[model samples]
Each structure stands twice: as C-alpha cells, then as structure tokens.
Target: MPQTCFELCAGGRSRGLAEIVTGDGNPRHKKVLQQDLECDIVGRNPLHTACVLGHSNIIQEFAKYNVNMNEPTTRGYLPIHYAAAWGQLDALRTLVELGADIHAVNFLDEIARDIAFRYAKHDCVEFLDWAEAKHALQTFISSVQSAVTEQDKGKLHKDEKLRCLSACKAKNDWLSNVKNPTRQDLINQKQLLEDTLLPYLNKLAGHPEIVKSGKL
Candidate 1:
C-alpha cells in the first residue's frame, strides 16, 4: 500500500509529494493529492502547510503547480501570515519572492508584518518593512518615468523641460544603483521627488494655459 498524502507531508517528503501531485509518479495518485485533506484541521492548504513547516522547497513546487500563494485559510491567515507567526524567515522570504501579497490582512486586520512583530519575529519584521519600502520606491520610480514621458509630450518651456529631464534622470540613476536602502533613504528620495520633479510636473499639469491647449 502507498503512503498517504498526510504521511508524505508528515515525513517531509516534499519531492515525493511533488512528483505524486504533478503526475510524474503514479497518475492515479494525482487525484488523491488534489483533494483537500482539511490540512490538519486548520483549514490550511498544502501550500500553507508547507509554509508553516518552513518547507520552502515544497512551496516552490506548489507555485509551479499554480497554487494560490496568497490564499487565506478559513480564519483569513494567509501563507505569509503563517510564515511570519511561526518565525519562518526563509519561508516568508520564499513567499515574498513568489509574489505573495505582503500587505494582505488577516481576519484580525493584522498584516504579516504586524503578526511578525507581535510574535517577536524581529528578522521577519525587518524584512517585511524593507520589502514595503522597496515597493514604494519602485512605485515612485515608475511614476517618475511616466512623468518624464509626459513632460516630453507637454508644451513646457525649454528651460523648464530641461530642468525636469535632468532632475528625473539623476534621480532615476541614483535610485537604480541603490543597494539595500534603509527606510530613511526611501523617505529622502520621496521627499526629493515631491519637492522637485513632482511639484514641477504638477504645476505644469495644473496650468490653465497648458490644460486648455491639451499639451499637459
């Protein structure tokens, strides 16, 4: 008789489970792995179970199987939340790299970072904080890129356009080369954009003459 799904998981046979579920092993076992097993009575899926076990290899296999990384359990705890709560830093990092929503809220309205803090998982907390700031910096960079494109299409004065272009390019270059930026680095960059390029672009966008001419 073949070992059961629960048996395989309990033994940490991630490779065997992957092969069975993906049909690389006995094709009949595929259906067995496909059915939900109630996830040890906690409403977790295989992916969530893998996260709780800190089995990042299993998580990667699940991702290849198209499992929803952000799927919430019955109580609204996402895989990220489980990883954070259990102090599974590596598992949490794997989830993040696999596109898990860092901002996802649990039933208690707590984010993964909040849970990490509550559980005294300082490493996970730091990683989540940095990830959020990096996301914000990336968003700001995209907006600056868009603004530069729009400025090229606008009817701003030659001097104004040159100034904006230079500033945007310098900021973009600096941000691109930034490595392991702290929160303060992110905040300062945002402040610079708001004070300089963004304000100039906003002024151009709101200018009555530019708006009337449809050149903003």
Candidate 2:
C-alpha cells in the first residue's frame, strides 16, 4: 500500500525508482546510490539535506546512472535550482546539461534566477540570465531592505565608492540597473545608493578623498 511506500521512503538507506514505485526499493539515497544510482530518484528533494551535504559528488553519480536531470519537483525546481542558489557550480552545470528547466518557479512565486540576483549570488546569475523569472514586482520589492544602508562610520564612503565603481563599469548601471537603472532613466542610483549610506557617507563628506570620491 502507499502507507508502506511512505514508511519505506521515510526510513531507508537508499531507494530505487522500482522500489519507490513497487514499495520495495531503497529507502534513503543518502548512501547506497551514492556510488552511482538513479540520483534523480534519490536526489529528488529540492534544496534538501542531500543537496547541501554532498551534491557535488551526488550530481556526478546521478549522471553515471542516467538519472533524470533537472526533473522538477512539485515546487517546479530541479536539483540545479538548489545547487545554483547555494553556489554549487559543478552541480549546477550537471543539472543544466541534463536539461533542468532554468526558469522554474518556486512556491513563493519567485524563480531561481530571481533568488540568485536578490541574494548577491553572482555565479548563479551567469547561467540564469536567460531564465530570468519575475514575480509581481511589488511582492518582490517588499522583501528587500534599503540596499546600501549600513551604519559603520568608516565603511559608508567606501561602500558608496564601490557602488559608484560598480556602476561605472556598466553604463546602464550609472544611468539606470541598480534601482531601475537605464541610460535614459537618468535618476542617479549612485546618489540613491549613497543616500542610503548617508548616515555614514555624510560624516566623511568633508574629507578630501571622500568628496572627490563622490561618496557624499
């Protein structure tokens, strides 16, 4: 019965697709298939403990077994989605090659790409660019605190200077990317970044290098 299946799935060293489907496969994939088993079946849980503990090797083993790569859970995430958010490039690539749906959304209505961007996970961004997913902007917007706000005295100007430098590299950054930036928008997110940092930036405005740095 399904109860037997659930109990078996909940308390085994490893379970296979056949076992899961037949109420007689391995129970936990935490070990057995670790060498090389249908990891898609074993490593199926999204952002699960298995992914966090040894996804790098687990991903490779799954490849050896021809496990369904990038198979989406009910939450619409593949193993790759979790690996990316956690900065596991090797696991991420394995999932991608297996054709994981890069654009899949999570229960929160936010997609993996958005998770990488909002959390400053740059490595994940490189692969997720084409997969950019959007929730209602308002839902997403409400989750962030003031981006550049921090209260350390010596660090505010330094933070602003970096913000300016980061923006300078990307023309759109200076003209518009941070805070809805675009060359035509012309609102000066640099100023906005500094404003958030103002509690600290203002204290350094009178300093020569700080002013010249435009940190204030």
Candidate 3:
C-alpha cells in the first residue's frame, strides 16, 4: 500500500527512501520529514494527521522516533484531541497506552473527553473517563507508598506504620478489582484514604525533619 503523507513525514524514514516509496519527487516532501511540517489549513503536525486518519500503526511509528505525543497543533489540539474528535477509538487507545495526557485541555479549555462527548463518541468518552480515574487511583497509590517509604521512615510509630500499610493494601485491592471506576468513585476512595491517613500525615507534619525533607 502507498504510504500516506503522514506516514512518510512522521515515520523518520530516510529522505531517499521516502522519495523512492512515495515517488512524489517533491522537495517539500523531503522537508516535511526533515522538519516537522504542519498542515497548511489547520496547522496540524504529522502525528495529528495520523490520529485524525485513525492510523494507529503510523502513530506507533511516530513514537519510535520520539515524537512528542502530547504536542498540540497550532490550534491547541493534541493528537488525542484529534482522535477523540474523529471518533477513532483505536487511535485514542494507542495514544493512551503511549502515555498521552488524557486530562490536557485545548485552547478552548476542552479536554479530550469533552471533545469525545461533544462528537457523540460514547466509546471514546467511556474509555477516557476510565483512563482518567485509573490514572488518579494509581497516582494516589504511588503517593501512599512514597509517604510510607520516603516520608514516614523512622518517623511513624510502629502502630501508625501498620495502619498506613493496611490502608495502602486496601487501596491496592480495590484498584485490582475495579473494572471501570467513575471519577466519583475515585473521589470517594481518595477521601476515605485521606481520612484514614490524615492523622498520621499531621503527625509527620509536626516533625521538623519531615517538613524539612519536603517529602510530606
């Protein structure tokens, strides 16, 4: 199959190879790969075009070249925003797996989920919602672990350490079992964990060394 302009431009292929494969013989085509060229009309980069076309393979190719996955277009639309707007679920999933920021807002202050919802892309909306919730839960879990390991070391009493560890285990278990958690579920669990750990966190805060470490 013939490579699209996006594949040729973003694939990081040699100019000679691109010329041979594309057979376009346009010098601007060479410049397109050598320099990150934007679309004339919308000013979208090659990665954005790949997402708009729902080309997951091309998106992965962009990743191989260390292309900025979260880089927005001239209009402030990320590759993810393009995928969401175009209802490209597979492309969106690829971007998410590659660590694209799902929470990023465009110039219009609309997140990818908002774009998905506006376009009536229910699957994309659901996936973005779940992805955001999962990311938040994982971040909270990491913070809890870090507090126990880095912040509370030698500071928390044995009983307090046990309590924090128990709470962490419960959160891990909850995350393991959760299939599709809502944002409200994340908020509730976070609040519960905060309530459980607030006393210990406060105790740590009182320690001059702990406060100095800035890990709290």
Give the number of the best model, judged by TM-score: 1
Q: Candidate 1 — which residues are off by over 4 angstroms?
A: 4-11, 36-42, 144-179, 189-196, 204-216
> Candidate 1: TM-score?
0.74
- Tens digits of per-residue lDDT, candidate 2, 1-216, equal 333322333333234333434334557544543433233454454223334443544444445556565566666656656666677656665566555666667766666667766777787776555222211121112221222243443444555656634533454333334463232233343444435444444555544443454422
Arranged by lDDT with the best first, the candidates are 3, 1, 2
Q: What's the ranking of the predictions by TM-score, best on top? A: 1, 3, 2
Q: What are the runs in model 3 whose C-alpha is more than 4 Å off? A: 1-4, 7-32, 36-41, 150-155, 158-216
Backbone clashes per model, in order? 0, 11, 0
Model 3 global lDDT (CA atoms, 0 to 1):
0.75
Error of 1 at 162 (Å): 9.8
Please give the range of 10 consecutive residues that has the lowest summed lDDT in model 3.
207-216
lDDT per residue, candidate 1, 1-216, as tens digits?
Answer: 766555565566878877667667576765676674345465776677777788888787778878788988878899999999999999998999899999999889999999999999999999898778766655665654555567455646667767866776777787779786787787677567556754456666654543332223
lDDT by residue for model 3 over 157-208, one digit each (tens)?
Answer: 7788788889978998997898766778976886787777777777766555
Alpha carbon lDDT of each predicted model? 0.74, 0.46, 0.75
